[model samples]
Target: LRRQDLKAARESIQAVLKVAPDFGYAQQLAGAIEYEAGALAQAVTHLTRAQQLMPESLAARQLLAQALLRAGDPAKALATLQPVLDGKAVTPALLNLAAQAWQQQGELAKAEALFKRAAALDPADSRTRVALALNQIARGDASALESLQATAADDKGTVADLALVNERMRRREFDAALQAIAALEKKTPGQALAPLLRARVQMALKQPDKARQSLEQAAQAEPANLQAATALAEFDVRDKQFDAARKRFDALLKADPKNVGALLAVARVRQAAGAPAAEVRTLLEEALRANPTEPRPRLALVEHHLAQKDTPAALTAAQEAVAAIPDNPTLLAELARVQAVAGDFNQSISSLGQVAAQRPDSVQAQLMLAEVQMAAKNFDAAVTALQRARALAPRDFTVAQRLAAAQVAAGRPEQALATARALQKEKETAVPGLVLEGDVEAAQRRGREALAAYRAALAKVPASTAVAVKVHGALLAQEPAAAPAFATKWMSEHPQDAGFLFHLSEVAGARGDHAQAEARLQEALKLRPDDPVMLNNLAYMQVLLKRPGAVATAEKANQLRPQHPYFMDTLAVALGAEKQFDRAIELQKKVVALDPKNPLWKLTLARLYLDAGQRAQARTELSALAALG
Candidate 1:
């Protein structure tokens, strides 16, 4: 041994092999130690001995593979990981290693797919997701979200782990979750997730001291577990013991100098203390070099880019991450949202659909998919998604809201009201539902009953936005001036909130006070520049007034976000006014792309094509439209 540490190293590694005979790292290190001591034949003997003890050992196989590779046998190296890959319950980590080997073997597509499969197998595996997303982008799938969401949703194991953890935390069942985690600890004794998860559960259950104690133990067990160590450090930081946290990380780095989690966490702590972006980026780069598949540092980079309005750069980062981790639902879903905002509905829908398919129980994905469908006028699909969401979470208010809208659009407003009423009855103990009952009454034209319902709601519930909005909107028909004054008084008492402002704007708009309406709209736009309905209304008003640049503004609104189908009809008008007949037809194509079930956009496109002298294309489009209808 050049370092003359052979006896000590042999003893340490021998002890590991005794318990974990097939341990790849140990056998590979032992073989390498022998090789470095000018003992190639001896190295082969040690590796051969390891192969006998652990035929499934990647370390032994890898050492032999490399031994063969060095002796001009690349083919053998390529075949070395078969046993590991063929093992049951092949975790994403092992899959990642196998994929790297595949890449080395020049099987690009197989490599990419395996990376994606790995990502799908482990949704929380940030590294695998980033790698898959990056590879997907390389394949010219600029819509990286499509693959990312698909992978994330297609997990092979329990997909409800996060929700389970959250639910258990809510119930203060930290001990139960920890009991499950003990199995994880036994399998990966020094893995950071075991104790960090236990600590998080403890913290959520309001046992701060216990949480701190668990983190301390985790740090002791796994010095490279930055999650646990950093969490403890943050508490120390709050206690003005930043030096303690720093010293802990420093000592950890001495052991695992390339520990990405510790480096990234340490850099983040520095950044929060007003360190330079250059410093943060440097640390992020170092972490990424240590683990290229990780998405966390890249996500931080995306945030910084977004803050600077460098959307294209942010999109690029998202695209790279999605490529590497096709199964990462969050990255994929967010990428879809970014694309949607960038005027790519078809891409967005594809991504949203993938997310829904993979995670049928994801209320967020369901709601988002439904909303996207509503924009495209796929009312049936929207309703279907909302129904699924209702099934998953019967008590979620957001699901109720979407279901109500879908019902209205699907020519089932009566059913919508019924559904809302049923939900309301279930919540009669709460003031909000009683008030919502008033809305149902108003929808049925039972104004007097609606007023009674409102009063009932007010009796129990404090004066709030929902109540005021309902009260003013319902009361205005019978008592105009009095209603306006009351509405204004309530609005004055609660300024700067969007829901109230929307109501006040609607009131002004209904009164034919265009100036006042425009002013309110401007204020609302300041709060939400991307409000599609407001944008459409403002564009329509501008168009009617023959205002300059109305066409450009209308087009911008259409391109930027989902609008009511009414806006598409309005956009058709805007396009015709601007004499962009051909472009108008393509915009109509977009409408159809948003909702293939809707025939309106198809008819519009067919007519526009005929007017533009594309008779053959027009005929084909007309035939499709007829078939669609």
Candidate 2:
């Protein structure tokens, strides 16, 4: 297994398991082999059985936890690690695994502390050092970058080097990323990942031609590299070269007919080209039939049915997938989602309840059940489920917050208020608790109490745009005139808060102060120049003001958030204002298609057609709009 001969190792383990079916050691060996082979479901099942049979085996527990983490069940992973974590024999490896589980749960502070402890225990362990550096980087510690770079330079491993490359790419150092990729390629010769990384870096540098060349080279060097082939096909689709895209997909299918990615890509291309729904559905069904236990194809099939508004079909597909993968959490979640979409709230609740029962140690499962109950307006049941989750994770802010929300929804405002106040006693939840308290008071129409809570939260985190937004909103709801003054004062103190500046712009726009709104938005752009929402708002404002640069501004906004209906609508309106009716009509058609039930967008599409002198198209759109009404 350590030599990477996973297939041989799996076969050897299976032979041992076949002879000694009840032997705990054989089960453990099989589980470890499967885990290394990336068969997480098999790994989890075998490891669980091994743990039950050999209850004292730390190896079984740790391997099971690792498998659960890889399967995206961090709650279960943490639970599996808890016994070891609380024991006297705690190791750096156990701490590192627990840290990863905490990180996945979004408990950054806990994860950081655990990483520090792991690093302290194993100061000579490069992996622990690398993990600590990564955790620090995630927490926005500036010194972590140097630490990570130093670790990467020390030749710790490929993982640390890749981490450095990822960090460089995330920071938009494309040139440095390319150099890192080049170094990695030299260190590990003939790796398909190198060209893929170079291609991504080239694309980030806006060298599309070079990126395409790198992709093609990678595809040629590694014929089985599906990522390279898929990316090239996506590029073809983007350029409207439908035939080229189909050919690429066909070649991929010819090489490996059971390839789920190729199958899904072909289905998406057919959908994009306005093919018959049956044709696309056929492709999705084929993918599902090819890989019954794989979640992606089944989920895609269900999503395709839902997108077509065939709730019955979606539910049936989801049920079939769950029947095939009965123990899989992802497929079960999808089943619940489909049931909820079909308005069978009781069925959704039952499905999630089964998951929670199966994994009683999983806080996530209980939380999911609580969410479904809340959606069904069964607040008491939601609260009950959340309380179970809270018992499992007593210090979890999310579980506590949800419990408070459920109490509020159940009309037990006093209980909710008590929960909120308790949260304020914890350092981790203090500000969020105050915010929640304010929300509860505002919901109950206790205006003064709400204001006081929001003000206290703002005092704790003076630069928090979210708390400031809540304060402004509560003030506005109670006293509209005073709200504007508060926003002005807050903006004066936190001049660099682009989010609050944008909020102030919205207030200015509502009061017919377009000049003030525009000035505020311009100031916000200086802080976050590429913010799509701000760009969209500024474009809409420019269109209303009849500014000549409106089309360009709206184009930039749409480019920033491609295929977003709101941004597309703004661009369409701006184009129409500039008398670019043809493109406006084209864009509006897409916007209306994206939101077919929106009469306003359809009305705009009709107007655009009329402006472009296509009276027949305009009449058709207007008639459809009337039918909608």
Candidate 3:
């Protein structure tokens, strides 16, 4: 075991355990072997047995606690260590482990106090000191910088130096971080971590060429490092080297064909490169086939179908996932979501109700139930569910916020305003509550009141792009003539804010100046290239101008955000302008289906059909449009 021959050690320990199954020492050795082998569950089982066999064995108990923590059962880990922790004589290691459990449980103050106690108990233990310093930094303590510096000075180790490097990077002291990373590299020759850190800092500094070189150095220093390779591939994607990124991910898949993560990564890269939807779906399906019970691939598949507006396909995928992972709450929740999207509200409600009944104390279960109930337009039911969740978690901001929204939707705006006022009493929730008040006012058609509330929200958070956008939208809805001036002033103050620029482009379009609108949207696109809404608008403007690239632009927008009725209509317009009548008609039909009540979409469908020379279909759509009018 000391030589790191964990495989041989595991074999030897298993053989001994076969003969002395009840021996505490053998069980303890087995647990150690399994832990060193990185088989955390097996290690926990063996260590638990060892503790049961030798109740007074401190080493056995400590090992069990360590195994439990590593297995991500931090509550059980704390319970396992409680006896030793309560004793008058507790080691620094035990205190550190308990502190980690508290940290994982989100009790930051308790974790900081435990870490301080551990550090005080053993001032010479550099590991505990480093942990304490890192915890202090995470908790945003003003003394963290001093603690980190002291730990780095006293420990003279790479771990503390690395923590200091991260803190420097967070402060945007890139040059200092690079120097520290270089010093660490000199101290530990042939280490991959220093180069990786250097590459990250270089990227943050916008030195892409230098970052690539550093990443290559990291990969060369550690040929087996999957993280370095993935990082390099992500950089290639950022640089628009799509083929290069695909090749790197393909190499990873070749090494481990059944790797679900690699498959998912490849699928994402393909999507970014505008690969065909079929190809992306196939990759996700392969990942699901590789790991039938893995939720990620299943969820991805469902989302993919949903993006295409293929609700039936999404429902099928969700059903298959639940079949594979029977009785799993997460998959069941996903199933209910797909059902709700497919308009099977009764089934969705029944499924979520079963889950909420089973996990009566789970706030998340109640929240999910509330979400589906809200989606189904059962606002009162949603309020009840959210109220139940609020009862379970009175301090939960999300639950309270959702409850207010549900109250407004249920026509109880007075109750919602009262709830919003209560939220405003809390400093952390003040801005959100103000926004909710604006939404409630807007829902009641009190446009002036809504604008006032939104302006108040923006006043409180002047730098918040989101609140600013809300204020701009409310201005356009309440007073259109004032929108352009407000947007112009906002752009002057925040030139790089893409959302405001997009809204400015909308105002220009509303004024019938398509050229100016297109130019503004193009500027916004430069800021956020993959913004589907901007792409759709630009494509529509291009179509109106009879531009040559509208078809490609519209297609790219559809690829980025598939299945939206409006985006689909824009693509159809662009396609018809380019004389791709067949595809245009096909897409327009789907758009009409999604928005059947919209006479404009029906008119567009009639035009596409006529363009495709399908006179019967055109007449049918025109008749439908006439009926709508």
Q: Write the per-residue lDDT of candidate 1 for residues 206-258, one digit (tens) a residue.
A: 78898898788776765544455667877765554556766767755664565
Model 3 gets an lDDT of 0.79
True-structure RMSD for candidate 3: 7.5
State which candidate, 1 or 3, has the greater TM-score: 3
Q: State each candidate's clash count.
A: 17, 0, 0
What is model 1's C-alpha RMSD? 19.2
Model 2: lowest-lDDT 10 consecutive positions = 156-165
**lDDT string, candidate 3, 1-629, tens digits:** 99999989988988988899999999999999977775655676689889989988888988888766554456668877877875777877787778767654545466656666766776677756666776677778869777876776666554456556656766778887887778777765764567777887888898988988987886676443344566777877766687887776554455446545557778877876657678889989999998676677998999888866678899999999888877767778888888988888889999888788767888999998888889889999999999999899876778888998899899999998887777788887888888888888888889899899899989999978888878888888999798778877888888889987787788789989999999999999999998999999999999998988998899888877765788999999999999999889888877776555567888898888887788998898888777765
Lowest lDDT sum, 10 consecutive residues, model 3, at: 221-230
> Candidates ranked by lDDT, best first?
2, 3, 1
Worst 10 residues of 1 by lDDT: 158-167
Error of 3 at 496 (Å): 4.5
TM-score of each: 0.43, 0.69, 0.68
Where does candidate 1 stray beyond 4 Å?
1-227, 236-248, 251-254, 257-260, 276-282, 295-300, 373-381, 405-415, 425-629
Give each model's whole-structure lDDT: 0.63, 0.80, 0.79
Listed per candidate, the RMSD to the true structure in angstroms reads: 19.2, 7.6, 7.5
